[model samples]
Target: MDGDFWHGNPKCYRVPKSNVEYWTKKIEGNRARDKKHTKTLKRLGWHVIRIWESALRDEEAVATKIRAAMMRHINGETT
Candidate 1:
């Protein structure tokens, strides 16, 4: 799971008036790193499940997603 702000959530991120360029670059870097890491992990045969902060608002939905992922992994369905 990742924070909406720190992970560059398109729905939640708003550039600060002060130091706009710096913040934009910093957040963009974070997003790039996250994408790279997720790709690397999947390449290494890991089942990467990314949960957004906003998704946590629905506890049941989050649990269902997690459970489904786990089931897939256990059943050798996830790559």
Candidate 2:
């Protein structure tokens, strides 16, 4: 997630909303839909890692988590 940039107002940012809100909005599926999809993927033997936008706020931690998830997926650790 990128940092907000100051608008013409000098105080207000040009973005529409916080990163969390933006992601939540972008992920349009309902909670039930997500649960079903996750369950299906898990049953199909996949490592499903869902990272929230807030997690990316800390670049280092985000990189670590992403790397770990990718490694785990590549190693066939799940199902």
Give me the candidate number with maximum TM-score: 1
lDDT of 1 by residue, 1-79 (tens): 9999899889888988999999999999999999999999999988999998998999999999999999999998964
Global fold similarity of model 2 (TM-score): 0.48
Residue pairs with clashing backbones, model 2: none
Residue 21 lDDT in model 1? 96
Candidate 1: where is the Cα deviation over 4 Å?
Answer: none
Error of 1 at 23 (Å): 0.7
How many backbone overlaps does candidate 1 show?
0
What is the per-residue lDDT of model 2 for residues 1-79, given as tens digits with 9 covering 90 to 100?
2223311222333434568576554443344466688899888877776555445658798889778988887887763
As a whole number from 0 to 100, the lDDT of residue 22 in candidate 2 is 62
Q: In lDDT terms, how accurate is model 1?
A: 0.92
lDDT of each: 0.92, 0.58
Give candidate 2 regions above 4 Å deviation.
Answer: 1-29
